[model samples]
Target: MDTLCGFMRDIGRHLSKPVVMTAEGGYANPVLGFDPAADRVVLLAQPRFS
Candidate 1:
């Protein structure tokens, strides 16, 4: 999660628009807490953690 936030912040510096994030293949992990750095998060499917 720290890596993701850091990457977002680094990329956001170059862009004029807000960052929208979506992750794949992280269903096995717990749901992530929201980060203020990201303007929006788009989850296309429900995550199954088991």
Candidate 2:
């Protein structure tokens, strides 16, 4: 999954750092999201690993 991880890395470069450490911004492929109030963090993907 090197390619996948690489893509993630690239996407990460575009994201803005969260003001609050507990928050995250990654919900789309090549994106990220984290929330302390939610009690979970998820990286939404296209579901197609093509």
Report the lDDT of model 1 for residue 16.
Answer: 37
Predicted structure with the largest lDDT when compared to the true one:
1
Q: Kindly report which residue pairs in candidate 1 clash with one another.
A: none
- Count of backbone clashes, every candidate in sequence: 0, 4
Task: Tell me each candidate's RMSD, in Å, in order.
Answer: 6.6, 9.9
lDDT of each: 0.50, 0.40
After best superposition, candidate 2 residue 16: deviation in angstroms?
Answer: 3.7
* TM-score for each candidate, following the candidate numbering: 0.39, 0.30
User: What TM-score would candidate 2 get against the native?
Assistant: 0.30
Q: Which stretches of candidate 2 lie over 4 Å from their true place?
A: 17-50
Give me the candidate number with maximum TM-score. Answer: 1
Judge candidate 2 against the unseen true structure and give its global Cα lDDT, from 0 to 1.
0.40
What tens digits encode model 2's per-residue C-alpha lDDT throughout 1-50? 45554454544444532212222464233434333344333454335576
